[model samples]
Target: MTDGVPTWEEIARDHGRFLYAVAYRLSGNDDEAQDLVQESLIRVRRGLERYEPGSLEGWLARIVTNVFLDEMRRRKRRPTDALPDDPERVLPAAPAADEVYVGLSDDIQAALSALPEEFRVPVVMCDVADQSYEQIAEALGVPVGTVRSRLHRGRKLLREMLSEHAA
Candidate 1:
C-alpha cells in the first residue's frame, strides 16, 4: 500500500497517460476519452485485488474499453459528424516528401476513427497498444480467431483509406 492508495491505485496513477492514450484512440474525442478513463478507474479499483499477475497496462486497457463499450451500448446510437465539402476546411495542403510518414500517421488516425467498433477495438489492441491476439481475445471475450479476422479486415480497410488519400 503506497500512500494508502493500494498498489493497484499506484499502478493506475503511474500509467494514467497510457490509459488516456488508449481511451483517446478508442473514443476519438478528448472529452469522451477522459470520461472513459475516469469511469474505468472505478472498475479498476474493484477488480484490482483479484487481478492476477500479467500486463498491468493490458488489464487497465481492457477495463477502460469495456466501460466505453458499455456506455456506447447504453446510448444505443452516436451522433455522426459530417465533414465539410471544402477540401481546405477539411484537410490542409500536402506534406513534403520528408514529412510523408508524419502525414501517414495522421491519415491513419483519421482512418482508424472511421472504422466500426467491431474492427477498431481489435486493431487498436493488436496494432496500436501492441497486445497479442490471444490477449485481445481474452479481454474482448471473443475467440482468437475473431481477433485475427478483425485485425486482418481492419488493416485492409486502413490500406484502402490510405491509398485513397495518396491518390
Candidate 2:
C-alpha cells in the first residue's frame, strides 16, 4: 500500500481470495473462476497506473465481471460442442482431502448458476462481492434502482429454487 497504491503482488496476496470468491459466484465453476481471476489480474496489472485510490476490491470486482461477460459473449459468438456423457468416461481428479472448500453449498451454487446473467450479476456483486448498489450500478453502467430490482428478483429466484430442492 505504498503511495496509496498497492503493488501487484500486494494486491494478489491480500485480495486473491476475495477475487476468487466473486469470480466463482459469477461463473459457478472452479476452472472458469480461476480463469476469470487470472484474466482480471492481468487487466489490473495493465490498468494499475490509471486506477484511483478508493475501493481497490471494487475495481477488481469490475474487472473480473467484465472478463466473465466478455468470455460469455465470445462463447455465444463461437459456441462449443458438448461432449457426450459416456457412463464409463473417466472423471477429472478430485481435490486433495486437506483442501478447504469455502463456497456455497452445491444446491445453492446450482440455483445461483441457473439464474439469468442479468439477475445473477447483480446478486453476485451485491451479495458475494459485498458491493454497494451504487458501486454495482456504477460498475455495471446501470441505475441503482435497476441493481436493486435485479438483486431482489435474483434472490427470489434463488429462494424458490432452494425451497424446491429442499422439498
Largest lDDT belongs to which candidate?
2
* TM-score of each prediction: 0.76, 0.86
Residues 47-128, model 2: lDDT tens digits: 9899989998889888999998888888778665223256443353364453335544777778989999999999999888
Give me the runs in candidate 1 sitting further than 4 Å from their true place.
Answer: 1-8, 77-103
**Residue 45, candidate 2: how far off, in angstroms?**
0.5
Q: lDDT per prediction?
A: 0.79, 0.86
Q: What lDDT is reached at residue 143 by model 1?
A: 96
Candidate 1 lDDT for residue 38: 86
Q: What overall lDDT, based on C-alpha atoms, would model 2 receive against the true structure?
A: 0.86
**lDDT score, candidate 1, position 60:** 79
Candidate 1 local lDDT, 51-110, one digit each (tens): 776777778778888887887776666333334467675554454564345657777778
lDDT of 1: 0.79
